[model samples]
Target: MPTDIAFLAIAEAQQLYHWLPAALELARRPGVRVSVLSPSDQLLALVASYDPQGILRPVRLRRPPSRPDSLFRQPSRLATLLLNYATIARFPTLVTTEISSAWLRRVPGFTSHLILIKHGAGDREGGYKKRHADFDLTLVAGEKDRRRMIDRGLCTPEAIAVGGYAKFELKAPRQRYFYNDDPVLLYNPHFDPALSSWVNHGPAILASLESLTGWNVIIAPHTKLARAAAPIVSHAPHIRVDMGSRHSIDMSYTMSADVYLGDVSSQVYEFLLHPRPCIFLNLDHRDGAGDAFAHWRLGQVIDSADALPQALARATGLQPGFVAAQEAAMQESINLSLVPASQRQADLILNFAQTSHPAKS
Candidate 1:
């Protein structure tokens, strides 16, 4: 007998990278079967690329039907889950990167142990949801999340594992979006209307970028926002706008950028992988002291897009002043270890499965 585990890639494609490595790792071990369930062919194709030997199974889920006249759209998380509830309930253990999967527990006769691998390291309140407590086990990137989740009563210390950042295991070659040696700035805004600076000041910020001399700009908003509208156009030669592309999610911008600009996106933590300059937009003027805005302390938080010029002007000169804080925050936000995060997470899952429900000979 073998333990069965299913990894759900049911959310946005951007989230797949966060948990796929662990799935691949689990598949390699003996006496465990690993399957990846996804509604998108593109996502399944990606899984196949990672598992060239076909050790892991890729199960293409049936998506709910859409209106024939409707434009192409990815199925909503709830819709995907509801449509595939029966298939999902068969597994003894299930792992996913998002919280919506918690809904599966509501299905009649559902008894699978739910595991959550948080996708981002940001300090947004949305990241700490009540539903997190429902998971049998939760995996996070670092102590920052482990502490916060415990403080918020979202999970007990025993139920949570600090698995480092699984997304960091993904390696993408850095791309040069601009030819010159000018500083490249990555403007990655979250898609949440109430929290993202893009919802309010995006166009103004883009317009202002044209006036900034000797700086190359990359406008890569969250994938959700990119899917909502037509691609943004930039007339300025120094500005490169990517609504959402492989480069946006693959760390191409985060790895290559010299300066980071955004509101409440977790990509800032990704950018801090190198401890570069960062300027956050506090356009809505949220409380700086709140736990949700804790990441704001890592950089300059400006209240308006009008300050963009001055911020960029002084970014490099001020970067040295923030290096220590940035490094400390990065360490707190992501636990880097000699062992890859994927391996640690895979090991934890294996231990949990065998102990929770051992297969009888």
Candidate 2:
């Protein structure tokens, strides 16, 4: 039988849009045939569009429209345990963002390798300990995250790393393009109510930006913002809130923007790949909460809507030394490159798939 590699992605719209295609390309090497198994229509379209020749097969799983209590309350490990076995039966190599050790137990021919790409904060790795078991390899993009995974006994030292951010491997530019005609500010708010400025101050921020002149604002919010009932800036001439319908996950906005405004979303890290100045919003400064990014000391962290205008002023007038420092720190944290990150990731996946054999027991 031909070597088949299956990539399981979250049913969520944005995750599918931004993360899935990169994984597909990484898997489509000489020995492997890649398939994307996801529930989001956006994901299906990306797979089809990225490889119209049917080079990568797109498989849509039947999933309930409304999220179930079990899945919603406890995601990551448990959710992966429930949905991944079906994919294991058809494909020997599995690449996923969320992997459950519990699911690995039940697969009939389960010797296949699993490579997990960690996409969130370091704190989210707590559940991995409960489901801990052996896997071929695991990749992480953040150093703090790699440490947490190691401390939790989730995977071995060799299996984890502050590996390069996967999206860094995708489309990138030789040098950041900054247009002096008008400063471009990209606002990316997290979807989580407790962690996002959009949940609390989006309307106020939108209204404030609407009144201001000069800076061009691109509100590329979390994809979930598209379906939010109390959504921010439904239709604004100046704002471009991501609808997820028309946009694919290109990081051009990150490369070109002069400044970034965001909450606790990982998109901020993506924006930081180019080492631009950013402003972080602190909606709830619940002290000792231990969201390390909040204390990252990379940029200004503001606590109110009123401070935004001044923050924008400082961002626009950033000194050359300050810009250099922030960019250097961000480079150490994200470790991105325009040339080889994705291609190396692609090579790793293909090499693993070719060398590993199926389970005998």
Candidate 3:
């Protein structure tokens, strides 16, 4: 029988975009029955468009549009687990891009090989956790993660492979929030309270930008940010506060924006794709040295909310001096080579899966 592999998109349905490229490529190969499964009709439809002839499984959950962050994912997980036995028996290699995939290891009658292709490539410490190293195989973004994981004794060198960001290969049109020719700015804040500026400086920063007539601000925060507490609403003509819009999940806001205003989100790297002006909010006073906060060194870093206006003004020029840093940071985050990263990742998984047998739990 052909080796059966399944790509699960339960954690973050929108994040399903990250795995589609590789999954589509895998489905085209011989002796592989690739399954693209998700609880979201929207994501499943998008996945089907990429591989119309392949299998598309939409596992209905108790929660509509079920995602790891959905208001009620516990019922979804419980229901999903109840249906996992048959799935594991057929598809022994289960691939996922979320850390929560580790939960599947405990599923009854499941001895599948769990593979992880992480969602983002950020320099933040939260990205490197002990839970991530549990997967049988991890498809990392680049050298930064691979080196750090091995050094931390969290991941074995043989168990890891560098499979650039496949989502970057997928097509997503840039979205424009404003009609006129105002320069766009993205104020993306991370969800971590200790590290995020959203609590102490996000509102103040928005208030400052409201008076600026030239720049249009998109205050899109990490999706989980609003879940933990009350949503921050914006009422400024020059600003658009998006908690978790399609524009936020896709690279729309990042591509459309001219200047990047962020603290520790990996989306900053996506914005750096075009090498625009960047202003980072350093509310926690993180060290710019070493890999812990290596991303902060890419652009102008401001510690106080009061400095945002001046920094944004100066950063609009994007200073010619920051070009080298932007290029360097972009390199560390992704392997933007001429070759198609999706096909490379698919081939790697195909080769590995063909050789290994399913584990018996």
Best candidate, TM-score:
1
Cα lDDT tens digits, model 3, 8-73, are: 766644566678788878767777777765555555665667666655444443344344444212
* lDDT for each candidate structure: 0.85, 0.60, 0.74
Instruction: Give the TM-scores of the predictions, in the order they appear.
Output: 0.94, 0.77, 0.89
- Candidate number with greatest lDDT: 1
What TM-score does candidate 1 reach?
0.94
Clashing pairs counted in every model: 0, 1, 0
Per-model root-mean-square deviation over C-alphas: 2.9, 5.1, 2.9
TM-score, cand. 3: 0.89
Candidate 2: worst-modelled 10 consecutive residues by lDDT: 66-75
Residue 135 in candidate 2, Cα distance off native in Å: 4.9
Poorly placed runs, candidate 2 (over 4 Å): 16-28, 39-42, 60-87, 100-112, 120-135, 142-144, 161-163, 172-181, 225-229, 234-237, 246-248, 286-291, 294-296, 319-321, 337-339, 355-361
